[model samples]
Target chain A: MATKTLIEAIREAMDEELENDPRVFITGEDVGPRGGVFRATMGLIEKHGPERVVDSPLAELSIIAIGIGAAMADLRPICEIQFADFIHPAMNQIMNEAAKMYYRSNGTWTVPMTIRAPYGGGISGGLYHSQSLEALFAHCPGLKIVIPSTPYDAKGLLKSAIRDPNPVLFFEAKKGYRAIKGEVPDGDYTVPIGPVNVRRAGDDVTIYAYGMMAHYAVEAANMVAEQDGIAAEVVDVRTILPVDREGILESFKKTGKALIIYEDNLTMGYGAEVAAILSDEGFEYMDGPIRRLAGPDVPSVPYSHPVQEAFMPSPKKIADAIREIAEY
Target chain B: MADQSVDLQANAASEQARPSDSLSPEILLEMYWYMLLSRRLDERAWILHRQGRIPFHISGMGHEACQVAAAFAINRGVDYVHPYYRDLAMCLAVGMSAEEFMLGLFGKAEDPSSGGRQMPSHFSHRKLNILSMSSPVATQVPQAAGLAFGIKYRIAQQLQDPEDETQPRLALTSLGEGSTSQGEWHEGMNWAGVHKLPFICLVENNIYAISVPMHQQMAVPNVADRAAGYGVEGIVVDGNDILASYDAMVRARDRAYSGEGPTLVEAKTYRPVPHSSDDDDRSYRSRDEVEEWKRKDPIARFQQYLLDRGILDQNKIDEYEARAKQMVNQSQSYADEAPYPEIAPSLDPSSVYAPVDK
Candidate 1:
């Protein structure tokens, strides 16, 4: 196993898929010879040529529409929106077209495409560049939403998402592109797209999260365990939609205390669903009230470093929340 | 034709209907047959709506000539069609059975389009390469560009890729003149023009987009005038003339398969009927205007043209009417008997995105 960064893991998964299946191709604003603004698709155009790695116009609506049509025509398309915040223009294509194609067509037609967009705030990428859009898509039933925390999970889960029969919205935490590193097995292996990854095992309180927030939750769990001996469980909810209900309940059952975290705003954020699920199904097992720690509903992460830092949940915030849940 | 043709578009209106060298009598009759079938279906739907059997009905009564002609001129199975709701004639020409249309109208389990999911006239036939439709206007326009792009891509990657190999493919996407105002429509057309994908767009301008007239939709007198902006050639055709519409689409298809890029064919016509069963056109337009357009009906003009060419007599015309009526009657019976989909009373996991729940 070799240690790779999160973005490197994503590129590796795409490289393998494009090599394995010629039907697979990538298209976005700068995903071609330019190698994408984030460089997540770097070296891919050199390996796969221009046709397999297409450069689309700046129109986000058409980008997703092309994916839908190509997918319908028996091609596996990985359409990247340059940034997470830029997906709004393509929302109709995503929500009405890609998301509902299968169900609307009554399973006769399926959109086997993946939409990749780098999301979240930590890199001083103010309003437009740093926003989380998972909650908005989580409400859509036909779409599979996957956001991985670690390099290993990013590689495996992305591969799984690409191969999934339905359309999957793969949101990469831009903050962890190079910062997060983990040992990823060489060659062929896929982490399935329906379960939670238990990063740390504990017996006191459970912390559930996804994307970059999940990475911070594990760190907070370790911090609480070392200093306060809070014994907190940390579960990375890699797949957001059709969430790992059984896995979530199992993790909550161990600790009997739940604290959900996310980088998106708190109002109806994805974590609220987890808290609701815990309250609904894990009620009898709960030893304390479920807690949610998320960004304040301020539209977006501001440009100022302190404000952006304040917007996102850090290790200290998660540790404090975990400690409070354990005490409760 | 227009007195002075625009720079970006070629005018396709013929002053009189001539016996076309391009179409044989058999092909013309086939086109007429489909047109009549679609009209009969549309009329029957209105009747059903009036009878309280169905909730909604949208008629393509006056748009049939261009619809059938454009469909007949194209390579049906090889080309893809992203049709708007008022494309009944086009769907029939592409091999969708009449009963299937009825099944869709009734939203029965046997409906091939959406299996009781979508409303009537939302045409879709998988085997014929007709893509499924959504209610949103102009959304399929971009999808059409994508289909053309996919075809171009697969052919370019023929050796390495395993997509079907008929090198040339044309994606024919059509919408009412109203849909051109949508942002997605521009996005779709721009993509087609930029890539020079094998694509053709048909904008059936029926004068009025429901209650709103053509003048309110855009500032330009013609939708074809917008073609230069997208770097594609546009054509204005007399949609009521079957021969002219056929010629426009045929020429557009030739340009696409030859790698000349996309062509926008704006077919000028009129919608005699109300927008749908839900609306009243009388509130907006006068009865005199409706009656005036009915005189220029495509079916009647085409029938008269065929008679002038000695293609058929009154006896043959009666027979065609009998055939269309019989098909529609049988389809209505079949759809009425078709079963409702077997969805559970509550939320069915299988219908939604639980395919990966395991």
Candidate 2:
């Protein structure tokens, strides 16, 4: 095992896949000599050359479209979007073409491609640079959404996403790129697409989160455990679409309380979906109402530090919400 | 009206000097047959839609010559096709049977494309290498580029040999004139040109995008002009002239195979009918204009050519028409009696993620 950052893990995943399979290639903006905007693909071009590590033009539609075609042509293409917020231009291709290729063709065709985007807000990236679009893409059937919180999950889930037969939207938390480091396995390993990882086992309340928010949830759980003696179980939902429903319910059943924390807007966020699932199955086991601590319904993410802080769900806010749920 | 006839005669004269002169009389006759079959099938589909038997119908009446010619130019089952909605002739020419078209029209379980999941005109046949189409226009353009990139990459890496007859594959994608205005179209064409990928972007300029006319869609006189900006060759042909289209497509395919990158071929034609069952061209276009275009109907012009060449007489034309009609009728009846697909439950939860080995 080696200690690595989330971005390092991602690069390693792509490097390993490119080495393992002849069909595997990386394509996106600045993914070649520049090594991506976030330096996630640094030194890949030097190792794999331009054909394998393609530096594409600034067009998200073609980026995903080429990935679809390459995937259909029996090439495993890993397409990177500079930021998740910039992915809207390619939404039609992703939703209509990539997501529906398998079912629409009656299994005659499959788009085995992975679209990686750095998502969420913590870097004061303003509106256009920071956005969490997991809920929107997760609503699209035939697509698997994998959000990794740590370097370990980032590496493992990305490998699995590259190998999956269907299209996968692998959202890497930009906030946790270098901020969150963990010991990842040295060699080949894959965390399955859909499974909830119980980070800290507790019995008082279940704290559900993914991506960068998972770390905050653990921090909040720690705070609650020290201050209020409320043992909170931190459940890192690795996959958002085909959610770890059984594991979530099991945690909720054990804790008798649930609090969903996310960076997306509160209205119809992934938290709402988790809350609905718990409401349907774990309603009888609930001690109080299922709560959600998420971003407000603002038009765009704020640019200012103070305003952005207010916009985001910080650990203090999550801890306070967890304490309130623990008391309830 | 006099000027239009002069242009048609000039187009016919130019065809004599084109590469189509090398085509055998038998091949020319076969081209005419597919074009005629597409027109008849389109007419039947419109009638069925009017009778409320089908939900929708997109006619390929005026576009048959170009679609068939392009299909004939490419290697079937080898080159990937990203066909648009009005590609009945293209699909038929690529070996999609009348039964499959009828099954798709009726949304029957036996439909080869989507098993009734997709609407009619969203053509897909796995054996023919036709990519499934979506309602969103111009989305397939980029996909075609990507497919071409895959083919080029495989050949260059020696993963697949170019010397192999079927090794060097090209991608052919069709779209309406109005679709050229879409950003995806430009992006896709640009990517193909940048990568020097083997791709052909065929724009069937039928003069109308539903109610909107082509003049209102773009300022450019021809859709192929946009190809210049992408650093690719652009060519225009009389879409109503079968031999002209055939020559253009043959040249385009050859250029692509020789690693000359993509070619944007604009086939200038007119939609003889309303865009689809839901559209009414009479509201936007004049009846007089439609009549004038009908006078230059591709099928009639091809029939005239066949008679002039002594390849087909009136008797042969009648026989071919009769066969096409019989095939359409039999397929319609078969599809009408076909059952809807039975919805089945998923036996494995991870089927979508992991391919279950058969």
Candidate 3:
């Protein structure tokens, strides 16, 4: 095993897949020469050649549409959307075309394609770059959404997503690309798409989070344990759509209190769905109402660092919510 | 004054350009048969829609000649097609049976396209390499380009063996004139042109997008004129003339296979009927205009060509029409008696999103 950043892990996963399968190729703006905007694909073009690592035009709709078309022709395409904020322009292709290809064709055809996008706040990317739109994508059926919190999970889940029979939306947490580093296995490995990982096991309360918020949830859980003598369990909900329902329920059954955290807005974010899931299935095991620590309902992510920090769910905010639920 | 005279002369030249007789008698006869069959099926579908037997109906009306001609020119079962809604003739020519069309029209379980999931005219048959279409207009343009890219890449890598054919496989995508206004169309065309991919873009210029007229929708007089900006060959054909459209498609396909890049073929046609059963042509168009277009009906024009060439007698025409009508009748009855599929337990929302073991 070797220590690596989340971005390095992603690059390694694509590199391995490209070398393993001839049908696998990467395509997006600047994915060929410049090695992507964040350098996630730095050295892929030289290693795999320009045919596999394509540099597409500045058109998101065509980028994803071409990927769907190529996938239909039996090629495994890994499409990068540059940023999660730019994915909206290609929503029709992703939600309507790619997602519905298998179901609409009655399983006669499938789009085994993966779309990766950097998402979340904390780097002050402002409105255009810092946005968590997982809720909009998770609402779509026939599409799996994967959000990894660490380098290990990032590489494993991305590899599995590229190999999945169905289309997958792999959202890489921009905040954790370099900041969150861990030991990733040297050889091939894949984390299953729809399973939860317990970052910190405890009994007093269950803190559900994923992506960038998973790190904060663990920090909050640790803080609550040392300061307030409360044992908080942090459950990283890896895959958003086909959520780890059993894992969440099992964790809730032991803790009897749930605190959901996310960087997206609270109105209809993924946390709301988690809250609903708990209320519907784990009500009998709950000791009090499910508490949520999430970004407020704002029009857009602010540009200023202080405003952006305030807009996201920090560890202090999560710990306070956890403490309130633990005491209740 | 000189430019006006030149324009008038060009119009006169186009009017004098008749359907080419280069195609063999057998091919011309088959084109006539498919055109007649498409018209008969469309007429029956509209009747069924009016009788409340079907929920919706979209007519291909005056575009049958172009559709059948283009389909005939392409390599079926090898090349890919991303056809639009008004491609009944194209689908039929590409090996979709009349029974399949009827099943789709009735939204029956036996429908090959979507099995009662999508509306009729959204053609998709895996065996024929026909791509599935969505309701969103012009969304298939970029997809066709991508498919062409895949075909080119595979052929280069020797992943797909060319089946005894000299020319490489290409992708054919069709759309209406109004759909050209969509940004996806431009993006797709630009990409194909830049890559010089084996792709063909066919625009069935019927002069209307639902209720919007062509003049109000586009700044150019002809949709093919836009191809110059993309650095691809553009040609205009008489959509009412099967031979003309067939010849144009043959040239376009050859150019694509020869590594000359993509081509845009604009077939100037008209929509004789309303866009759909729910639309009323009288609101946006004049009855006289529709009646005038009926005089140049593609099926009638092709019949005249056959008669003039002495390839088909009046009795033969009657027999062919009867055969087409009988086929449509049998298919409609079969689809009407077909049962709907039983709802599967897995279709439930609770089970659909349930976590599965890895």
Top-scoring candidate (TM-score): 2
Candidate 3, residue A295: lDDT: 81
Tens-place lDDT per residue, model 2, A1-328, is 7899999999999999989988999999999999999998999999988888999989999999999999998899999999999999999999999998888887788999999999999798999888999988988878999999989989999998999889999998998899989998887898888888999999999999999999999998898889889899999998997877898899999988999998988898898889999999988998998999999999668999999989999889999998888888
> Model 2 off-target regions past 4 Å?
B1-17, B344-358
Decide which is better by lDDT, 1 or 3. Answer: 1
In model 1, what are the clashing residue pairs, if there are any?
Answer: none
Instruction: Candidate 1: list runs displaced more than 4 Å.
Output: B1-20, B159-168, B354-358
Clashing pairs in 2: none
* lDDT, candidate 2, B21-63, per-residue tens: 8899888988998998888899999999989999998888888
Q: Is candidate 1 or 3 superior in TM-score?
A: 1
Better of 1 and 2 by TM-score: 2
For model 1 chain B, where is the 10-residue window of minimal lDDT?
A: B1-10
lDDT of 3 by residue, B1-358 (tens): 0010112233322455433446788878888888888889999999999999999999898999999999988886568999999999999988888999999999888888877778998888887888899899999999999898887777766777655363338999999999999988998998899889889999999888998988887787888889999987888877887877887788788888787899998888889999999999898888988898899898889888789979999999989989998999999999999976557832654322223336
Residue B43 shift from truth in candidate 3, angstroms: 0.7
Measured against the native two-chain assembly using Cα atoms, what DockQ does each of the candidate structures obtain, in the order listed?
Answer: 0.66, 0.67, 0.55
lDDT of 2: 0.88
Which prediction has the highest lDDT against the true structure?
A: 2
